[model samples]
Target: MQIKPKFGVDQLLFGMKQTDVKSIYGNPNKQFKDEDQNVIYVYNQQKMRLTFYEDEDFRLGYIIASDPELTLFNNTILGRKATEVQKELEQHSFKTWEKEDFDLAENHFNEDHWLILQSEYDQIVKVEIGAIIKNQDEFDWKFGAK
Candidate 1:
């Protein structure tokens, strides 16, 4: 399947994309979900004490940094999609549940969440985007003349 590159605030603001991200970073050590449904992707830049998550519809979210709250565009700290749902495991003592409809901005924190909750149109289901970052360093750059 063909995967088109998606854009986000960090990517648009910093001009970083997936390819640029992977070239200079490592893999995330943790991945979790919040109360909403936005999948939280976490990447550990051990030396920098930073973590990232990729949260959005298919591909709207960007790489979010933890600690200082620095966002690195184009790098998905966690290798998960917002539409993905992690089955509640038995060890965590959390029951298996699906993501309900909700927004990331209005209903949740911008640092914690990305968008706002505006789906008042039905019983919505979404994955919770916990404190994570989505690193998108996987595509080739097409902008600017280098």
Candidate 2:
């Protein structure tokens, strides 16, 4: 299925209600609330996970997709060679950063969103798209001022 690129997956983006997500992707395989009260929806068959912050009107805040069928705006497919994906992203003028094991590409259309490609050797094993929560101090405590 060709997924239309958006802030999130397809029409699912920041400020979209949970019901909207369900309407498009159907009910998640599993759902739960974290200790922080954020709702988590896992679609194992689709190889995707969506997270919504409880404080943010229960809107979609994060999306992780490892499905090979999913493709970015530039038609970059998940699980492709990292170099190939990098080239596709570069061709679209998206700024990229090379990490130790993976690479990160910032969405040129939306600064708050990012694409995380987990790589092994020279191949991308996973892909994640998510919004950057502004109040890192309150929401993301894992990485503190680093």
Candidate 3:
């Protein structure tokens, strides 16, 4: 059996934070009232939603992704609450983050992790590895997957 090398979705959700959502997608596109009249931040797209809202305390609210791809990501991560994702992110070594989302190519990945930014023209990916670095290495970090 050949096990594909892909990052675990559970890991992605484990250490995520509300700030991570904001940093990734900026602000939500729409705001509206739920049945409770709480301010709902709706970053909605075709059949997709990355919503946020505040509780009575006014602290950072939950950031949720309501898309089918989220379900296919990893069963362990399915239906994960915002707080759950934040916890997972905390466990992994801190790596640089990207705002965009989409497919990543092999060149984008290092030995350990890669952050891919979804863009209109091209996808930007940032790679991070677990190793000691005495100095910077020169590699053409930007290239298409194809």
- Pick the TM-score winner: 2
- Candidate 2, residue 81: Cα displacement in angstroms equals 1.9
In model 3, which runs have C-alpha deviations exceeding 4 angstroms? 1-20, 46-55, 60-64, 76-146
Worst 10 residues of 3 by lDDT: 1-10
- Residue-level lDDT tens digits of model 2 in 65-127: 777777776475765776666666665665655455314432222233356666655556567
Cα lDDT of model 2 overall? 0.64
Model 2 segments beyond 4 Å from truth?
1-6, 74-76, 102-113, 132-146
Candidate achieving the largest lDDT: 2
Q: Sort by lDDT, best first.
A: 2, 3, 1
Residue 27, model 3, lDDT: 64
Model 1: ten consecutive residues of lowest lDDT: 123-132
Cα RMSD of all models vs. native, in order, equals 15.9, 7.5, 17.1
C-alpha lDDT of all candidate models, in order: 0.30, 0.64, 0.32
